[model samples]
Target: MKKSTFLVFIIVYLFFSISGFLFPFDSDWYRTLAKPDWTPDGSVIGIIWAILFGFIALSTAIVYQERGFGRHNSEYMSLLGINYILNQVFSYLQFNLHALFATFMDALFITITTLLLIFLAGRQNRFAGWLLLPYFLWTAFATYLSWLFYSLN
Candidate 1:
């Protein structure tokens, strides 16, 4: 992949990150819901996403830098980007979109996509793969949260 391609992807990710800032803390219905005791504080969401996206960016860059596996790596990279976008779109549903079921589905898909990227990267590049473990853990936790939210409210 060219530097331009990486730049474009980063720019797009940053756009989602910027959009996240506009979201008010999950209040009203969210607070009223019965969530797990381990459910993360809403205030931490932005920080966690920033850290996850940063690792994702690093893994994407590393994937592009490797030799002899461009084609396969590109597929995972594309999925990562697509899933990341889906993840952001899911957040919008928590606010404006009323499809709690669809939002849950999106969260599940995002978790699967994240798992796929982690598995593929783990096989191809250990560092890239390691970078995503935190994201995978976060998504796993977030998946439960999404399920809980939909279930309770």
Candidate 2:
């Protein structure tokens, strides 16, 4: 990947990471919830996100390198935009609204969008497609966890 493309990915990753600050963790609310036995702690969540974001940045940079901002890869670009927006929406639902059900549904959207992106990337760059596996697995696991929260609460 070009330096410029990598820079863009870094900017995007930072933007999302910083935006998370807007949603402060509510210990009071969280403590009352009936989470599963295997629910991870805050530190685990942070570590997962850091690794996931790294994968996302690298995958995005790879795609950008393979297909620059051109008409040929417009579909890939569109999926990326959709994934970004839905990811933010999921965060909003989980944090601001504190709506577990809504967050779970939004997570499903994210997982589907990511799967689609993987399918599209596979056509152009197999490496990029394989790179998203960790992301997809994490998001899918998140979706399941969110659903549990919704159902339990």
Candidate 3:
């Protein structure tokens, strides 16, 4: 991918990352809720999300480089858009609304979209698909965590 293109993707991802600040995690609320013993600390979760976003940006740029806009790759683009929105919405649903069930469902969709993106991107660029693997795995784990949160709280 060209440097400019990669830089643009990184900027877009960073823009999406701003949602975390807008709907900052409610640590006080979160602490009162029952949590799984295996749950990672807030800082750890933040670090992991930061790394995953970087991976997502790189993978998206690589996919775009390999398969530019066209009817041929519309589905890939659509999934990417859906995934991005769902990814950002999680913070609002979890932190602001405190809707554990909705957040759990959102996490499920994120995982599904990530898996679909992986398949679609892999068909065009294997490296892009590989890059998304961490995101997919993280979302899957997050879904489980959300489910537990919903059940426990």
Candidate 4:
């Protein structure tokens, strides 16, 4: 990948990642909730998100590289846009609005979008699909976690 493309992807992911900080995790509210025993520690959660975003950035760059700038890649871009928007909404729903069920629904939609992304990207670029595996796995886990949070509290 070109340096510029890589940088753009990184910047975009970081921009979306900023949503978490903007809304901020409500420790007090979270503390009162009935979380599962297996919930990850704060540092671990940070590390996981960092790694997942790294994968997403690289995978998206590959997709862009393969598709190039044109109307041909519109659907791919649209899926990415939807996925990114949905991804941010989860943080807002859980941390800002304190809507656990809405968070789970958003997460479920994010997972489906990620899967669609994998499939669509794979048809043209197999590496892109392979790169998103961790993202898919993490989102799947997140969907379950959100559901657990809703069910418990």
Clashes of each: 0, 0, 0, 0
Total clashes for model 4: 0
Badly placed stretches (over 4 Å) of model 2 are none
Is candidate 1 or 4 superior in lDDT?
A: 4
lDDT, ranked from best to worst: 3, 4, 2, 1
Q: Which stretches of candidate 1 lie over 4 Å from their true place?
A: 1-16, 21-29, 67-72
Residue 42 of candidate 3: its Cα lDDT?
Answer: 92
lDDT of 3: 0.90
TM-scores for all candidates: the values are 0.79, 0.92, 0.94, 0.93
Best by the TM-score measure: 3
Worst 10 residues of 1 by lDDT: 64-73
Query: Which candidate number has the best lDDT?
Result: 3
What lDDT tens digits, residue by residue, belong to model 3 across residues 23-124? 998999999889989999998999999988888888878877887757888998898889989998999999999999999999999999999999988998
**Model 3: residue 95 alpha-carbon error in angstroms:** 0.2
| Tens-digit lDDT string for candidate 2 (1-153) | 578897968976775565367676666777788999999986788788877777777777777787775899899889988988888787678777899989999999999999998888777789879988888998899999999999999
Give the Cα lDDT of each candidate.
Answer: 0.74, 0.82, 0.90, 0.85
lDDT string for model 1 (1-153, tens) is 787557844864586576476655467756766777877777788788888888887776676666433565577757876886787778777766656777788888888888889887777789978988888888887777788777877
Candidate 3 stretches greater than 4 Å from native:
none
